[model samples]
Target: MLDVCVITGEDGPHTALVISAGGVVSDAVAPPGTPHLRPETITLLSALLIGDWAVADASPDGARIEARGIVAAYAQFHLERSIRSLGHIDRTE
Candidate 1:
């Protein structure tokens, strides 16, 4: 199963969303912080995905938590997202 994490962080009025696919995908909806691309998010995401944190109960809409788990790897490729989205993404506005 492809567990996907829709990480949406906000810096003041600006917001950035990063969707990561891993095991036990989770969503952390807390007050967003400054917009910056760091490995911090990937590390947190890995912990959530591997630990099987409360993703299943937390998401129920188009979002979901898969039971099969995934080979959680730390991937922080802003360029990839940008290219894939056709320059539709950025860490900052």
Candidate 2:
């Protein structure tokens, strides 16, 4: 699951700041396609997901604001799975 927000630049293009459960962070064109995911809002989300990364100039949506909790929950869930999977890597021998 991906927690994404659609933010339109002052000029017009939309961009998303995304954070993965495994602690990956990046920015990209909003509504990512194919296999890529979108970004999160510029707020506590970035801080919660990563230590120093920050979110900036994100569009404010009341609907999306509420989703932060849900997204965080899922991200944590995924993170747990990722940790468990790492155990298998060591056993792959």
TM-score of each: 0.20, 0.24
Tens digits of lDDT, candidate 1, 1-93: 122333432222212232342122222542345222223333444445577566434443222212111111123342343224423534231
RMSD for all candidates, in order, please.
Answer: 13.6, 12.1
Whole-model lDDT per candidate: 0.31, 0.37
Candidate 2, which segments miss by more than 4 Å at Cα?
A: 1-15, 21-31, 34-41, 44-74, 81-93
- Residue-wise C-alpha lDDT for candidate 2, range 19-84, written one tens digit per residue: 432222234443354123233443434444465433322434532453344455455676664333
TM-score of 1: 0.20
Q: Name the top TM-score candidate.
A: 2
Q: What lDDT score goes with residue 74 in model 2?
A: 52
Instruction: Identify the leading candidate in terms of lDDT.
Output: 2
